[model samples]
Target: MGSATAQALVASSSALNAAQGITLDVAGELFSVGRLIGESTALSGALADPAAPAEARTSLVSRVFAGASAPVQDVLRAAVAERWSSAADLVDGVEELAVRATAIAAPDADIEGELFSVSRLVAGNADLELALGSRLGDGEGKAALVQRLVGASLNPATTLIVTSLVRQPRERRVRRLLNRAMRIVSAQRDRIVATVHTAAPLSAEQRSRLGAVLTGRYGRQIALNEVIDASVVGGLRVQVADDVIDGSIAARLADLRQKLAG
Candidate 1:
């Protein structure tokens, strides 16, 4: 979140956006490098250490990611050329770039929806979430589990994002990782994600009107991912980024109870 990390991410994002052909391969390679750095404290530290010479860092990238594709090596070189806020931030930046590259490769894919579905799936299954997010478990095992569960049904971008997250969670929960990935995918499409929770599913007309209203309010097209939550009672709860518009009766009752008690 520091200036250096932000600047590095922006530069890397532009590079990914400008490149064409072999993007999917680039994404895979970046994900692999990110995972490697994320799991290795020493390697990450060596790359992000400001005291070290830039050439040394670049050389380290060349040595470590030497087998990666030329495009991937180029990305790593660009990434290491800049200073990072922390070792962790370096890993995060690489992972974010990987996700962005994947999104760019599959411009027409509904990656946000697929990510949301995976988040909900993990949230609903505590054992599965624990298994995948367990720090004690093998990263490859978790990745294999994701592959087996998703099979070929998911979009390639979705699969890559999920696999990368499962492998290098970096102390994040599965749900948080998926939400972040969803936001990244949404930004790639020049849209924002709105999670709408309602007692029942909205009709097509209702969905259209809701989307229109949200777009007007947010000044951007909204992608609605509807969730049927009976706890919402008679109304809806919508979340856009960090903002929550809770019109649900459940929220109202809770607010009223707190006010009356006070």
Candidate 2:
């Protein structure tokens, strides 16, 4: 996001945080608005056009989202009032707000874990990934597939988030979109994601210990998402934000080969 868009998001988030009645319902409404804008190039262009006056864009939002609740309207108004880099960024910003709002409404839920589980499921199954991420596929059909896959297990917040992303992936890969959602959920809880790739699944005890070590190192709580990669051979590769700790045997072997070649 550009500086202006980021500033707008922060301001809007602060307002939502301060509001008393913001709920998952509000987030759902925002998601609906985002989907509507994403599917309609004309609407997105009008809302995101920097050349258009902010008042006009907001007026447009009020008309298009007339039935949205006050809280939802507040968010949409704030979103459309900002200067976006492009029409697509406007949609992306709205979708991001929807995810964040869901996270805020479901503070006690394990939303980050749920999003990660869905991402892993999609990553492991090529057909499922294609079905959900396919641009040519019907949006409703993709939503139905998401419902069948995880609707029963997830909370309404997770369901809305996953369904919205799958239905309108825009230019994002499904796994990438889910990962971004997980990060947003983690940020809502004042935590960071620690993705662990290992040859075998870690025991609960191992996971706890790793979490403790990472927490001590980063000075923040970690939400661990484990990926079982047979190619790892041994040890693990840990990624916390941009910092990576690659202790896997595969990495070491590759380093040794590079040194030999040098």
- Tens digits of lDDT, candidate 1, 54-78: 8999999999888888888777878
Cα deviation at 162, candidate 2, in Å, is 0.9
TM-score of each: 0.89, 0.90
lDDT of 1 at 170: 78
Q: Please, what are the lDDT tens digits per residue for candidate 2 over residues 112-230?
A: 88898898889889999887777787888899889998899998889989998888888689999999899887877789999999999999999999999999999999999888889
* Alpha-carbon lDDT of model 1: 0.88
In candidate 1, which residue ranges exceed 4 Å CA deviation? 250-262
Please give the range of 10 consecutive residues that has the lowest summed lDDT in model 2.
11-20
